[model samples]
Target: MVEIRTERLLLRPASMDDVPAFHNILSDAAAMQFWSTPPHQDEAETRDWVAAMMAISPGGGEDFVIEQDGRVIGKLGLFQFPEIGFILHRDAWGRGYAREALTPVLDRAFSVHGLACVEADVDPRNAASLRLLHGAGFEETGRASRTWNIGGVWSDSVYLTLRNGQRDVG
Candidate 1:
């Protein structure tokens, strides 16, 4: 596992110690609105999720916890190679942490991991996430409706990708 550092953040492998803070993010309704699943009802759910993240084989995937000043604020990584996912505490929103954390992860994904490209599936209504992906040089590949039925509510998806050595197309 690799530990990455940025000007203001640390991207490290997840651990059982992260369960409490991760549960806080996973349990927040506002933060989970665009997530694949609904807000978790308890820490047990987050524990299971974190355990799964920890169990990812080094060659199979990458999962990193995002920390700021030593506090867990979010996470950004590829639990499955070529497909990246991330989340931040609501309190950490609009702070540029996600954007800052993205560059290095994508770099490693292409360089160290030898991936040809990285992809993202954003909920069509999640404007902020769309902007972040777009700004990070990801271009839209396609769109699909009724892609996810989270908690019985249908959500559409916008697919985007950034290839290795690719420059911003916008």
Candidate 2:
């Protein structure tokens, strides 16, 4: 469980203590609009999710809880190797925190993990997230329609990747 610090944020492993704050973000409808699933219905669900995060096998993945000003703001890191995922509380949006937090995680993914590339799957309608990944050096690789069916609504996906060398791997 590695802990990371930025100028204004802290990225650390998820814990039971993070459940309340994390649930705040997970339960927000607007914040979860593009998430793989709908906003969590209750704190119990969040607890299960955090418990699962804590149980990931060593070297299997990382799930860093993003904290700012000593408060949990979101989560970032690869729960699955080579494929990155992140989400922030709606209140933390548009403040550069995601980009700031992403820098070192990408560094760790390539340098520490020695991965050839990192990938992301974003909902096409999530313009802000797409811009964030692009600014972090990810490039669009492909797109698919109706890739996710969440809470009865279907959403498409845009696949992007950032190679270790910061160049196109194609």
Candidate 3:
């Protein structure tokens, strides 16, 4: 029941009610082009994914649906501890919603959850995601080659991190 409000968005925990919209977003090839897996083929796949996400206990993980004007437009969350990821409907891109949605989530991770730092792994070729991380004050921490076999393609990864106080981690 952790909910956060930004100037233009509401971030709330995902629920079964969000499955349809979640499926729509996840099934978009363009929107999911950089995802670890290909676009979900159908709603059943999304249903299973959302079911698992909704079943996570508090403190184990956090997944929030991004809402604009009461419509679900995307999702953002932590996976295990500090690893973070997000996805937005392609139509919502270039509108600064990702940054707007991520800032407060990072705040909660640092101030509310008391985490020392938050990290993200992005495919190096995903320029928009790399730019988003950098624009949000996360610094590049490392890089790796063929780190992930995403959708059968060997993908390099760029690791970025933001510590409490946005301090550089040595």
Question: Which candidate achieves the best lDDT against the true structure?
Answer: 1
For all predicted structures, in order, the TM-scores are 0.97, 0.96, 0.93
**lDDT of each residue in 8-126, candidate 1, tens digit only:** 99999999999999999999999999999999999999999999999999888897999999999989999899899999999999989999889888888988999999999999889
Per-residue lDDT of candidate 2, residues 18-100 (tens digit): 99998999999999999999999999999999998889776888778999989999998988888889999998999999888
Task: Give the poorly placed runs of model 3, Cα more than 4 Å off.
Answer: 167-170
- Model 2 gets an lDDT of 0.90
Error of 3 at 109 (Å): 0.3
> For residue 16, what is the lDDT in candidate 3?
86
> What ranking emerges by TM-score with the best candidate at the front?
1, 2, 3
Query: Per-residue alpha-carbon lDDT of model 3 for 80-136, expressed as tens digits?
Result: 668898999988999999888888887778888889988999988899998888887
Q: Is candidate 1 or candidate 2 better by lDDT?
A: 1
Q: Once model 2 is optimally superposed onto the true structure by TM-score, how far is the C-alpha of residue 52 displaced, in angstroms? A: 1.4
Q: Positional deviation of 15 in candidate 2, in angstroms?
A: 0.6
